[model samples]
Target: MSTIQKDSAITLHFTIKLNDGSVADSTHNMGKPAKLIIGDGSLSDNFEQCLIGLTSGENKSIELKAQDAFGMPNPDNVHYMDRAKFVGDAEVEVGTVMAFSGPDGAEIPGIITDIAGDSVTVDFNHPLAGQDVTFDVEILSVE
Candidate 1:
């Protein structure tokens, strides 16, 4: 069996859970594992550290902090825009997630936090940011 190492693409089953133990995501639930290349920045450095020496068919659980996982919510990502900016038949309501073209021409998502008269407050932070998360991993195969 090949051992998981840096830059190796390994197939594994993983579950992301909150501190409360409720699962946020899991491949075992789908009955299939996911494949990812090691050291590709797809997994956090902390998450990768836990798999460094694991071989095929190994199972382990790893915990990561906010900074090591999805990272802290950045205040700068939050912005307030004119409610009119969201024109058309769609109602500009609070808690609605909308995507708009950013300066880089890519679509950026922002959630409406408040709907003030002629103004809408939006936050673009990741939903999981600023929170610690845990990963329960089951190595299915390594190559």
Candidate 2:
């Protein structure tokens, strides 16, 4: 029975729920468990700490604050772009998520939050930002 440690390779199923009790994400919906190595930058330190001593076949529910979960939404992440930039077939409507090239050529996903004349407001913040969340986890294996 291996306990989760700093370098442990873990396999688990997780369900992330928002404060409103709506499901945000779940490996169960994907029909497969997720695997990860601790301290690999895939999860925040606060999130990983919750699994410090957990072993196989354990079930745990962890509650996280807004800041700890995804950090509060940053106002700086909101930008106004020219509506003309959204040309072609894609519809330009509020609540639409679109990806654009970043400075490093990586795709940055932004959600359209507003549209006014030639100005389109795009928010780059994580969709779950500023919301407290709960993680329901079932540890399948730890090595």
Candidate 3:
């Protein structure tokens, strides 16, 4: 009967639904419960707050504002790249998610938002950014 607190190890199944009731993500879809420690920097502070005080075998539905969830889309994250950068078999089409190397050499995923002649607009913001979401969580264990 451990209530979730800071640094608590938690095992849970969660479904994230958009405002339109569309399933955005779900651990159940992955066929396994997710395990995480509170304040591990994985879940945002606002998201982690919703789990506080929850015990094992608890079910809760939490609604999060766009800014509180994945957060509002940052205009700076939207960049316009040269169409020439995309070569070879890669299709230059809208709605395609591509991974680009960051300054640190890490792969950063960006979605093609627009294509205008030689310019291609890629949005690096999270796909769910700027959208409010609902979290349905079933806590399997909390310690």
Best by lDDT: 3
lDDT leaderboard ranking: 3, 2, 1
In model 2, where do residues sit more than 4 Å from their true spots? none
Per-residue lDDT of model 2, residues 27-138, tens digit only: 9999999999999988889999999899999999999998888889999999999998998889999999999888899999999999999999999999999999999999
Error of 1 at 137 (Å): 1.2
The C-alpha stretches of model 3 lying farther than 4 A from their native spots are none
- Alpha-carbon local distance difference test for all models: 0.87, 0.96, 0.96
Q: Quote the positional error of residue 119 for candidate 3 in Å.
A: 0.9
Q: After superposition, how far is residue 39 of candidate 3 from its true place, in Å?
A: 0.5
Write one digit per residue (lDDT tens) for candidate 3, span 67-102. Answer: 999999999999999999999998989999999999
Local accuracy of candidate 1 as per-residue lDDT tens digits, 1-143: 79889998999999999998899888988988899999998988887888999998888888899898888999998898987677787678887888878899999988888877888888998777888898888888887
TM-score of each: 0.83, 0.95, 0.94
Residue pairs with colliding backbones in model 2 are: none
Residue pairs clashing, model 3: none
* Reference-based lDDT, residue 97, model 1: 84
Candidates ranked by TM-score, best first?
2, 3, 1
| CA shift of 96, model 2, Å | 0.5
